[model samples]
Target chain A: MATTALSSPAASGAAAAPEGAMVGGDRKWALRWAYFFLCLFAAFALMPPLYMLITGLKKSSEISAATNPWWVYHPTLGNFVELLTSRAFQIFFLNSSIVAVLVVAITMAISIPAAFALSRMKFWGSGILATGVFLTYLIPETLLFIPLFKMFATFRDWTGIELINRWYVLLLLYPTLTVPFATWIMIGYFASIPRELDEAALIDGASWTQTLTKIFVPVALPGIIAATIFAFTVAWAQFLYPLAFTTSEDQLVLSVGIATTLIRADVFNWGQIMAGALLGAAPPLIIYAFLMDYYIAGLTAGATKG
Target chain B: MANIAVRDRAAFATTSRPRGSAREFFRQKSTVAFFFTLPLILLIAILVIYPAFYSVYLAMLSKRMDRFVGWSNFTFLFTRETFWMVVKQSCIFAITAVIFKAIIGFIVAHLVHAIPNEGQRKWRGMLLVPWVIPPALSTLAWLWLFDPSYSAFNYVIVALGGDPIPWTGHALWARFSVILVNIWIGAPFFMIMYLAALKSVPAELYEVAAIDGATWLQKLWYITLPMMRNIIAITTLFSLIVTFANFDIVRILTAGGPIDQTHVFATWAFKLGIEGGDIPLGASISLFMVPILTVAAIFILRDINKRGERI
Candidate 1:
């Protein structure tokens, strides 16, 4: 029974014969069980975001009322409108956008050539350097934030330049988080490209830069997209770095801005807070929705393909 | 394809061999490679490597950082109850959350793998939503869900004729709540990774096991677990480090509150080092994470190297 079920050709477009019918029956049970658990897991996974949406659409009155907490009796756009129009929220959005965009650009600029060199060009200590890059990627930001904080403070003391409480410091700090992973992803993709492609370019009297720009970049476009998405998401989602580094309201990114600013002392504004949270989560969600295949490819490629 | 390229490269190298020029080309290529990697090396050196060593030095300083008090901070932390509690809590939080995340991820991956391929993409996409959202933002949603007055979960419990549990107001419950949220956020990552691993496992192995009169349990024990061992190890170690260092969930949810019962190394360090203005003490607390992280990193490096060899 197990053999027939496991070896069933019913999934491969074969018509179900008498024995194949039994196998299909078994497979059907398995599929049903799979769907049942998948639904359960999906609910657990999506509940918070769904709740954010539900609360984001509710009024403060509705939220405060002793009604069904799960459902919004009177959904309102007031929260969204208020958050979208608020000066503080808009500044937070703008700051987040600036940091994310600049970080992505810096990350790609640093990682692409590094990945190409590490993967394709054999050099002294290239192998150790690649491994060192991965190790650096593993170092969590939490471990470094304090020393970085002090370092920035000391820099201010020495050079009369303030690095802390500034939004732009993130552009310097975020690449530490992003470049190694992006370079690693690009290396995996580049290494898989047929060496013939680059060798042919080299033999055609193309400079190494010409070969990279013309041949490798075009071929590894998917990997580049994947790396870009990863860099963007990391930059956008980073919380600890911003929270530790930047303290002022105007300097705060969306994640830190929403968490710190939206909730005033001792008064929890669930409606507006949820609205802010939802908007804060929007860019990454939107990117994941459209480029989900590349997103997942990047994710799996990090562990499996590496 | 690789064979032909190698031969062609050999032919080209010999034909273009101007005895000393070959050495010069090698030198030129190395120079280009060095230039390509320069930015990365500088970034890591200034931001990552320098701070790492600085933290070590910072940890050895006095509270005011005016004096070098060697091992005094370490002794002080060892003497403190909160520091010990933080050590215990950090370990429990990381281990428990990683265990649950791994279990849930493995199970969900199997379920997703069992489904028809056509519908798999939609299910996989939906399931990964938790991981996609920024944790700081989603933890806010969780904070609302676990609200004392407007707790949706407690409301459900009351409707079912059970008592409304204080999700974060209590110490143990707050620990549970944080770990639950971490698992909820992290399990989808494990599921996605495991699902990819499952797809890569050849169908022939399962068929062969089935034909040998093996039960589904036997097949899973022999085939699936072994095939996924490297991924499982790497993912678990990676998750362990991340979870152990987790700040967003604990900080956003409880802020290591309920009298500091839920404090992990990161949040405790933050509370001590930044908020309290005791930078040296905080640096010392944060440095406690290095041993665990180093162990996990070494294990991951070994597993990745083993996988590289296998490939």
Candidate 2:
């Protein structure tokens, strides 16, 4: 490095060689500093989950063994093996999968047609309606869940259909969270399509439904995939609603199930809890690993391109 | 002369017509649009619109939802000390967490941006793992890390001869723990957004500024910030609502513990309504968030409208 720093000045063959060398040195240090902090922040960002993996691999005996918490002396897959075999954990995974897939279907059914209409077909108050769609997308689940809980109770009271402890009943509630955002993103995607292709279809006497199914749906597959990923992840990661609504062992999704079941009394099953958390997070994490570009594109499109 | 002109115009209109009026009206684009949007409108009405109004109705009623008791529930809340504490804590938590998330996101974005494009993708993926993990599940990981008896952090600290801090035990540290967890989970989102914004910036602006003797900081202040102002406003406003209405981190970490010091509206509302069995009171507290969130939502919508116009 020092040799290059010295060699560059002679190679330049300029009167300001020394000054240029100094500037280069300063710029090199700046880049190094950038890398230094980049790594520091990356460690900060990645530490928790990595630690979860580390902790989950060790037995409770090792965790409480006064050894280095960061290292596992007796490394074992016992935690993973045990969790993978547990009947309750299996139930949690199954429940989460069922809810996520059903919710995705509901989200797609409601949002795709709506987005196509809003984007391609103009109406009296389409602009205002579009704005309202975006507004509802911003309403966080935290604010909506409580009132939703009451509304569900009211429905049950009126009809005597028991939904409080049923897993599939989440089908009724999860769309409230998924559909708005899905529709909003889909609207942006459908709008980004050029008008002429659909216009030609319309002029050729194809109906609106035909245009959506034949042209728009196939073209906007990336948007549909993006929305599907969003809905699936939201349904999978949801904690509060499941915790509040479903109390039975048979009904709990993986997220609420892990937090409630494993940490009974003061006997914190740290290993199994970590394993469960990781397993619960696996679907979104794997999807993100594969579909990051579409994921990010969808995210930014929903935000910056709205 | 007027009658002749009128007759000519009428003839022109009738001859120029392409289809029957009723069929044309039925086949209108607006009609198609309404039918297409009907399912979505129904879902929004039953799920979103109804519950929002119901929450308001609940805030004014008794615990049982049988009869209205005016603003008694809200008035009762205003008199509670814990309610006041929660309000202050929610503001502090959201603002502090957001500020740190923004700052950290900005710095990390610039750092990542400075690196070669090929390397940035790997770094971004590694960095976004926190974001990809569900917050509830992720918070479980955090909860274990901050475990009082066996905190991994405190082990390191104690080995270095300092006292092990109670991360979620005391009031201030509990607040710090929640905020730190929030920042950890949220900063990557900000980083990804800001990085995209940075990518949109024209590189020539930096070259011009550099030629004009602008330092790195000055160029960032002048070129990077102003160009990204719309995005910055939109992201911050978006984060504010999400942070204010955040429940998972607080719920799992402290459960609004250490004398109810960490309670935000969502967790606090859950405590009262679901656990405490005062549905009306909980609904009222949740409704309190509506005003601020509504304001933020409006700004974002208006900003998006403005952005849409520009596009």
Candidate 3:
């Protein structure tokens, strides 16, 4: 599979010509059609973010003006500047960063060890537990948010400690969205590591903890990175949990903050809203750009490797 | 070191101690594994499992939650015209969206697979941009593009002398708009997954098929589809659950607007449960997702188990 993935289609096309000129010709046409559809799909896929960039650069005056919404007449960084300087937007950014970072920490702390155990320890019920983790990952937060909302509210009533409408509450809620998948990813990675490596470490008088930390973690660094990226992205981009759990301007994360607070009733700030949305989307996009391979590997690994 | 000492003790205990003794039990792999997994177990129980059961319990309660009212919220939903619309719309949204995403993903995956390997990465990167952005943020972009007055798409249509689309003003268009945005965000995921699946298909099979004079369609029908059946099924099932329970795209794009014609299970549940302060009704509405999700989950588990056995 790796060899095939690395081999160029042109090489394959050339190789097929020995079979028949008709086959080679068919391959050429297929390549041409492939490029055509690929370009079309690329345009469709890129249109929204491209539009967001275009609209974000415009002035509010120009946005309201009767001009081409596709092209900005006066492209300015005013919207970006305004949002960057705005206290509410700053608060949103800070909240999102804190929540995402902390959630990533907590998710890794829980999932890595759990995944190590489930994959390596050969414990009773470990197989069932691994499957259960995957199933938990499948449970959509939308299904849980309403009941969780009530649960938080009831906790407030019972203990007089409010969990809802607080930014910190997201630290708790986002894990429900992130940890199971992270664990599943880690389990896949750890399971793929040969048992002989850990067995060697165990024979050398290494404790299970020492072997896990010294041998497994280093070898599975790519999977750990992938899981960390997955966890961070999920926590950062989480909309439902934050939107349900936090409502106040100060409490809201970027996804909920930019979606809700940026547009007041009956009045839309298109430029700043687009700017905020773009900025809100920037961290994950940046991470994805730098670590594109790991990101895609983690994503496909969940299903294909499962 | 403490670690070496612990390891030594463990070795000694295993060698000399009775199997079921307290110290040996503590040193057992199962016990250590149980401790390692305890945090995960607790988190799932407290957050996921508890809320899942609580959602059912919430669904059974009266609107104000002061009294037990078994199945009445669901019964009330059954009587409401809006509830039925929501159910139909949710089904249409999920089913139509998943079908389109899977088809588009398959086609694009094949296209990407057909291209030269050097160009594949660039095309794949560009094609996956939609899936990379946070859906809420990207949906905001779509929301702007679908704005009733200042639609960029309308600008192009009007420039070409065609009628400007309502986009979100009309009911059908609102539904179309939400689903379009959904496909835009979701289709790339399918593309990525299918591309990965495509790569895993052995090229030798295709070579053999070509040698046997199989047409491209025959190759796809027999080789590609059969090889990718598990991934295709798993991705579709996963996307079905997600699209059925989707909140971001519909919530941001349409907000169940145009007279609630576009509300899926998630957004409608949010509307009734959160915004409307009818938690029981909302929970009841959200509970409707379970039957379909469970069915999909069962299929997914079976496929996964089958794959496990094969491996």
Per-prediction TM-score: 0.93, 0.93, 0.94
lDDT of 3 by residue, B104-150 (tens): 99999988988899999899988988888999999999999988899
User: Can you tell me the CAPRI class of model 3?
Assistant: medium
Candidate 2 chain B lowest-lDDT run of ten: B7-16
- RMSD to truth, every model: 4.4, 5.3, 4.1
Q: Quality of candidate 1's docking, in CAPRI categories?
A: medium
Question: Candidate 2 DockQ score?
Answer: 0.50
> What is the per-candidate TM-score for chain B?
0.92, 0.91, 0.93
Candidate with maximal DockQ: 3
Estimate the TM-score for candidate 3. Answer: 0.94
Q: Per-residue alpha-carbon lDDT of model 1 for A1-306, expressed as tens digits?
A: 988887775554466566867776789998898898888888888899999999999988888785898898888899999999999999999999999999999998999899999999998899999999999989999999999999999999999999899999999899999999999989999999999999888866677888889998999999999999999999999999999989899999999999998886686888999999999999999999999999999998887544
Among incorrect, acceptable, medium and high, the docking class of model 2 is medium
True contacts kept of each: 0.84, 0.77, 0.82
lDDT, ranked from best to worst: 1, 3, 2
Task: Encode model 3's per-residue lDDT on A1-306: one tens digit a residue.
Answer: 888777856576566556676867777898898888888888898888889899999998998886988888889999999999999999999999999999999999999899999988887788888889999999999899999999999999999998898899998898988899999989889989998999878867776788889998899999999999999998888899888778889999999999998887577999899999999889998999899999999988888453
Candidate number that wins on lDDT, 1 or 2? 1
Q: How close to the true structure is residue B8 of candidate 2, measured as C-alpha lDDT?
A: 64
Model 1 Cα shift for residue B100 (angstroms): 0.6
- Clashes per prediction? 0, 0, 0
User: Model-by-model lDDT, in order?
Assistant: 0.92, 0.88, 0.90
